[model samples]
Target chain A: MSALFGRSRSVLSRLVGALVVVLGVVTLTFFLARVVSPDPTNLYVSPQADQATRDQVRAMMGLDKPVLEQYVTYLGQLVRGDLGTSFSTGQPVRDDLLSRLPATLELATYSLIIGTLVGVVVGIVGAVRRGGILDHTGRFVTVAGLALPQFFVGLMLLWIFFVVLGIAPGPVGRLPVGLVDPPQTTGFVVIDALLSGQWAVAGAALQQLALPLITLAFAIFAPIARTVRTAMLEALDADYVRTATAMGLPQRTIHYRYALKNVLLPVLTMLAGVIGFAFSGAVLVEGVFAWPGIGQYALDAIQQSDFAAIQGFVLYAAVLYVVVYLLLDLLYARVDPRVRL
Target chain B: MSVALAEGNLLDVVDYRGGFRGPDGEVTEVLAGVSFGLRRSTLTAVVGETGSGKSLTALSVLGVQPRGFVRTGGRMLFDGEDLFAGGPRSFERVRGNRISLVFQDARAALNPVFTVGHQLIDVCRAHRRLGRKEAEQVVLDMLERVRIPDPLRRMRQYPHEFSGGMAQRVMLAMALVSEPELLVLDEPTTGLDVTIQADIMDLLVELISSSGLTACLITHDLGVVAQTCQDVVVMRSGTVREIATCEELFTAPRDEYTRDLLAASRLVEAR
Candidate 1:
């Protein structure tokens, strides 16, 4: 009974911690949005407007109220899932942000999948070979990836593949402008294309997505490879590895079955970090490709000083980061016996 | 009398030389011209202080030496087959099927994620073609053969769940599952308590005899050699200092190193 109670207490503690973080982020973001240099009401009003027009615009935007009162109103609206109207688009900020989020999620997911597979395989091979030529070559590639910044890589890829080679699809958008209809299931163009059985549309979407994904993946690949290689090397030296070898198990079996299982936690932790980094890094890649993702939206918001849009974007990214990290922690606890719940 | 005199040769080592690379990539010799041979169906103990190349010699025979260490010269023959002639692939076929090694620490030796039964089954599956049920039965039988109380319960338990002695027994079971011609015990009883050490040694001795398997037991304890091994090889500073029958070495030693080791054992026994 006491053990059960102890478990319940830990669960409660985790919930409380998550709640405090969310509350703090929301409050800080609300205050920061209110304190920006330009008055938000002026962004919507004409310069030659009369005094009555100016006062009406200020009152309409709630800019006439004190900062604390405005903050309280924002918090109450946020609790109700109302992100308010955007001054620039005259659309609901929540709808605009939500609509853009899925595209970024799709891009991030694809980039993560490609990065993890490529990184883990190379890392394992490098570690297994240690000082051999394969190990040396893998290290060189990883170092190159680590040193090259994301935007530079993206620009170079565009120049080489799209301009010089002229083999890849042109950098217009995620899918061909009007040639294909979006799929209904997930609204992610790639998934929708695949689900609709339109191989050409799927192929075109993939081709369009390939350059940005590679750019994002290159930024993540180096760190993931380094982490996995270190973890694999440590696992290779473990006693169980020696024991497995002593048992006459094949080298591949020993490496994949015994060593890989133990090192998965470290690799997964690195993967979680990469996922978070990729979300932020996607901003540059998306802008370079002209992909309509939340990252590009965020960039536009920064340029226009769209305070509500910026706050919503930041909040969305924070929630994404927190959710992914939480899921990873749960996964790690399941895979490793040493981790307490 | 030496068991070497009683039975024909099972394992022979001659002129072994192995070492790791220094920081500057120069060869730093760990084993220098060490040589010994063991008779069939008997335990031969290699006694040495720490870093005396005892474990290195055993690893060389198994063809699983540490990285960066080169075996510059050696001929290790088991049942008249040269171990060094074959590459890693060929060595894999002979290792664990013809010869198996038990590491010094059993707790670290066994895979923590797997049950003892699973490890045993894996050994069987690696060397032979057996169905899952048959393999499991073999594991249970191995557990019983090692004198583990309640073999069923013990087989299901992981390495960490077992006591030190029990873990050692599981390791022995793993090593002997294929009934290899030779078993290398690298300080098998070093980390156990006094009482547990005695029990494990007795268990090993009984298993070796009943299975008619040869053993090369490596330890620094002369007393353990006197009790369990028929022949003894004394090593110091990466060189073999003496080799003799257990009784003869204990009673009439030649080298001062052997004599010093016996004297140390006597001091411990007296205490």
Candidate 2:
């Protein structure tokens, strides 16, 4: 019964923490938008426009209302899933944000899969061959990866592959601009294309996504690999590993089964951090390639001083971060028995 | 002790030399020309101080020397087969199936994340071809054989749930699961209380005599060696100073190191 109560308390704490984060993000976003220099209404109005025209623009954009009134109205609309209209494009903020979310999610998913696979394999090789040539090579690669910035790497890749080599086509959007009729079951073009048996479109989308995914993956790989290598080394020296070897279990079995299982806690913790890092990398890579992800959209909104679009984007990213971390915590608990909740 | 040796010789180690390389690449021997043998169904205790190469000798039998430390010269025969000559693959076949080791620290020896039953099942499945259900039944049977209370309930408990004695029992069960011909007890009861130590020693003796399993009990306790082992090998630094029957070694010490070790053991018992 005491254990049950402890579990309940943990669950309650998590829910309350999540609520606080959401509230804090919404409040800060509201204030930050209001405090920016040069009113947002001026972005949409001409410099020589009449005072009446400017007043009409302010009223339409809901900027003429009192601050508290605007917040209450925004909160009420948000509760009903209405994110408000964009000040410049006049499109529903929710629709615009949703449309670009899939692309970013796809990019993040691919980069995470690739980065984790490469990082863990390299880490294992490096640890097993400590002080050997493989260890030295892995260390060199990870260090090089850590040194290069994501934007710079992305530009270099574009220059090498698209400009100099001319093997792959130049970067445009997620899909070829000429392919208008994207299969629309899911907003993720790759998944939708595969589901609808449009292998060509899916193949093309994957090809276009590969360079950016590699760039993002490289940006996050060094840290994950370093963490995994450290964890693996620690596990290799653990008593259980020696016991396993003494049992005459195959070296590979001892490594993959026993050593890996014991060290997964550290790797999982590093993996959780890598998810956030990947998201940050996606933002820069997205802007570099003009991939039509939420990152690029947010950047455009900032430049245009579109308060509603900026607020919606920031809120969306915050919610995403919170959900991802919550899931990661639950995963951590499941993988390690020591973690109670 | 002579009668126990008359049964059959199970293990023989002759002139074994092993050492690690220092940072400056100088070879520092941990075990130098150590030699001993065990009868088929008797327990032989290799008594030594800490860093006396007792554990290293046991590891040499299994070909599990530390990395960067080469076994320079050794002839280890197990059941009439040269162990040192056999490579890792052949060593693997003999390790868990024909011989097993129970480490000193049972808590660290067991994987903390897995349940006791799971660890037992893993041992069973590794050396034997058995389905999961069959392996689980074997695990429960072994648990019961080890005298764990409520075998089914204890099987579900993780390593942390067991006391020092119980965890050592689980380790014993794991080592004997495959019915290995030889068992290496590396300071198995060193960390346990006196009462628990007695219980573990009795369990080990009973298991060895009943199953005819040869055991090399590495320990610092002369009393434990006297109680459990038939033959005794006293070591100091990296060399074996004396080897004799348990009675002969205790009744008449030949070397100063052996005498000092016996004196220390007596002090421990007086405490």
Candidate 3:
């Protein structure tokens, strides 16, 4: 029973830690966004307008207040569940981000799954073979995959898979232009479409999602595979693994069950960080693909100097990253008995 | 010392040659030639310094050498059957069932991610078809046999939580759980304290003697060989310099390397 309490305590502390991260990101972004070159109101009231017009626009946007007072007001608004308004869209930042969130989450989930599956198999083969051809291939891919940015990979996929062979759908939103969308019940059009029995819409959305998912998956694969391979190699050489081998356990059991289990803790740690970073940091890929996700929303907001939207984006990303780490910490503490005590 | 087999031998390893393959695909010989035998009820010690390939010889017996360390020329006969006849498949059935090894660095030899029970249970079931309850019972029984107090509670504890001596005992229990006829222990007391080392050697001797089991101990400590083994093989630089009964080798060393080792042992004991 006490152990149960301890686990809950750990979970509670993790949530508290996440809140602190939110506070830090909110404070930092609030201050930093203020200093970036373009004045947000210049996009609104004319830049060449008189000082009186500029002051009027600033007052209306709550920017004319002292910095601290604005921050206090921002916290108050956030507590009341308002994320302020996007200057460019004239829509509430919260609603805009929420609508685009499902798309980003779905894309990130598929990419993370793909990356993990590909990385683990490749890592195991590399570690088991050591100096064999698979090991060398994994090493080369890890180096090249990490160095090549996601947008470049995205464009390459677009050319090869779409332009060259016309195999994939074009750089469209979640669905092709003429296809009808399923009813938006859950904000995730794919799941919502499946729920409402619109298989065609779900299928079309998935087809459009393929290239971006591949790009983001490739982006996240390098770090995970590299970490797994290094950790697996070390584990394969561990004394316990040798002991297990001496026990005459089947080679498969020794490598996968024993060696792989030991390698998992470190790999999971790196994987959690990679997925968190990739989920919120796929902004460039989003641009190249024109996917209707928060990455695209964030990019447009940053270009137009939309102060409120940028702060919201930073808060969301920080929260997502923090939550990912917290879950991973709980998992590590559970799986690795060394840390549990 | 090689087992002086009057009637028959349980294991015979003859002119075993092993090496590591470098990136250039050349073999760097680690074990030039290692030959030894184990009879029904004898404790033998292979004493050597670091890089002398004592551990490699032991690993080769269990067919657990690293990928690069290949046996270029050798033969291992266990109970009249050539162990090398099946190319690892023959030992696959014998290892952990008929022969088992307790490695150096017991702490590193046990996985840190699991409780003692988790590992012991798996090992128990690895060779025998036992249910979870039956396997767990075997774990507790083996821990008790190793003289570990509070076997039930210790089962839940991780390797890092145990002392070096305690961890080595746990490993001993793991090796003995499967009831292998021949046990190979590789420097089991290397990192332990002097007092703990004596206690561990005593326990090992007591267990092996009570069961009349054959064991091969690989170590650099002459004191350990004297206290725990009946026979001793003095190895230097991957070659056996002297193989004699424990009493004979220490009193009348045949090799200069053995004489130096004896002198070093006496100096340490005197201090």
TM-score leader: 3
> Which residue runs of candidate 3 sit more than 4 Å off their true CA positions?
A1-13, A37-39, A131-144, B1-7, B23-25, B267-271
Of 1 and 3, the candidate ranking higher by lDDT: 3
Tell me candidate 3's TM-score on chain B: 0.93
DockQ score of candidate 2? 0.54
Q: Which ranges in model 1 have alpha carbons more than 4 Å from their true place?
A: A1-13, A34-59, A63-70, A176-180, A191-203, A279-281, B1-7, B266-271
TM-score-wise, the better of 1 and 3 is: 3
Ranked by TM-score, top first: 3, 1, 2
lDDT for each residue of candidate 1 in B1-271, tens digit (9 for 90 to 100): 1213223578888778878888898898888888889888889999989999998888777777776889889777778767787767667877799899998789888877777788889889998799999989888988888889999987777788888888998899899888799999989998899999999999999988888889999998877887889988888888899888888887788999787777877833443
Residue lDDT tens for model 3, A116-219: 88988888888889989989999899887899988899999999999999989999878999988788777667888899998999998888989998888887
The sequence of per-residue lDDT tens digits that candidate 2 reaches over residues A1-341 is: 99889988997898789878987999899988888743676777789999999999889867798989988998899899998888677899999887787788788888898888899999999998888999999999999888888789999999999899987667797887777546687677888988888888888898888888888888778888888888899888888888888876778878888889877888877787778655532667888888888888888888888878888888887777777788777887777776778
Candidate 2's residue-wise lDDT over B1-271, tens digit each? 1122232488888778879988998888877887777877888999888999988888777777666777878778787778877677668878888999999889888988788888888888888899999999988888888788899999888888899999999999999998899999999998899999999889889988999888899999877887778899888877888888988887888888888888877843453
Q: Model 3, B1-271: lDDT tens per residue? A: 3433344777887777878989999988888777777767899999989988988888888888776787888788888788898976898889888999998789988888778888888878988899999999989999999989999999999999999999999999989988999999989899899999999999999999999999999999987788778888877777777888988887777888888888887933543
- Which candidate has the highest DockQ of all? 3
For model 1, residues A214-269, the per-residue Cα lDDT tens digits are 99888778888988889999999988898888779888888998899887888888
Model 3: lDDT to the true structure: 0.85
